[model samples]
Target: MSFLSSNPRLTQNEGLAPAYNSQSEQPFAKPPVAIESYIQDLIEQRYQEQPEASVVCAWDGDFTYRQLNNLARSLVALLSAQGVAPEVFVPIYFEKSRWTVIAILGILHA
Candidate 1:
């Protein structure tokens, strides 16, 4: 016999599982916040705490937050000029290197 069938209480109360009703009262609702604002705050914190800290380290070279941000902006401009839509998923397949870190940051910025 099945495990639930072995326990009568489990079988009888199976339909009483927690259900989410949008029309009903919500106890966990919170104010909405912009993701970009959060990201900017994190970036600012990193810069202020460790301005020279290596944010991306790879086989080729390591990058500080300043470098990564600059590279990401350059990449965003280049991709935008080439008609790369913000909604597009640009696939990046490459070996581990500084370029990989740049690509990851670039995608996030895009």
Candidate 2:
């Protein structure tokens, strides 16, 4: 069956709001997940298993974790030279391209 048909009640106006609300109300609670360290641990594990695996790939080329890290560092340096601070929200308006990917990675690394 199609997704919309499977959840037929959602198609009705009265059924829409509470069905959404019921999904969100969970009595049991779990510990909050730490995402940053989790991501770092996964990266470390991947590097340990296959040091040559690519982390970031673009239309121009594939960049390994080490290469992306180095590129990010260099871009961060360039951004620093232009007086961008750690907390500053620099608006990046650009057409989608490899440079945009590099800029995003650079910002994350910074």
Candidate 3:
């Protein structure tokens, strides 16, 4: 099933941020089982846990988690400002790269 099929809240465009974080008193009751369910959260955590880790490599060179998060956040701000909404289809055609990953996370945030 699609994330849109499972997460009714997607239609309402609520809870844009990750469900749990270091500041939370209690753990998020259910960590998203499907990798696609909470990609922004997962990527953010991965960056915090290991920012220097190599997450991408293209003709330009290697890209680290920190770079990916930074790119995604930038994309998020642009996309959110453009009124991108949850569960809405957005066509992003690009070859696989750190940038594409960033776009996915940004779309999630949007």
Q: lDDT for model 1, on a 0 to 1 scale?
A: 0.71
Candidate lDDT scores, in order, read 0.71, 0.67, 0.74
Give a tens-digit lDDT track for model 3, residues 1-110: 57757785653334444443332535565585655546567777888999999987877577799888788788878987888888888889987665677777788888
Name model 1 segments beyond 4 Å from true: 1-41
Clashing pairs in 3: none
Candidate 2: what lDDT? Answer: 0.67
Q: Where does candidate 2 stray beyond 4 Å?
A: 1-32, 36-51
Worst 10 contiguous positions by lDDT, candidate 3: 14-23
lDDT by residue (31-98, candidate 2, tens digit) is: 56667664445654675677677876677677776665567679989988888887888788887655
Best by lDDT: 3
lDDT preference between candidates 2 and 3, better one = 3
- Root-mean-square deviation per candidate: 8.3, 6.3, 14.8
Model 1 earns a TM-score of: 0.55
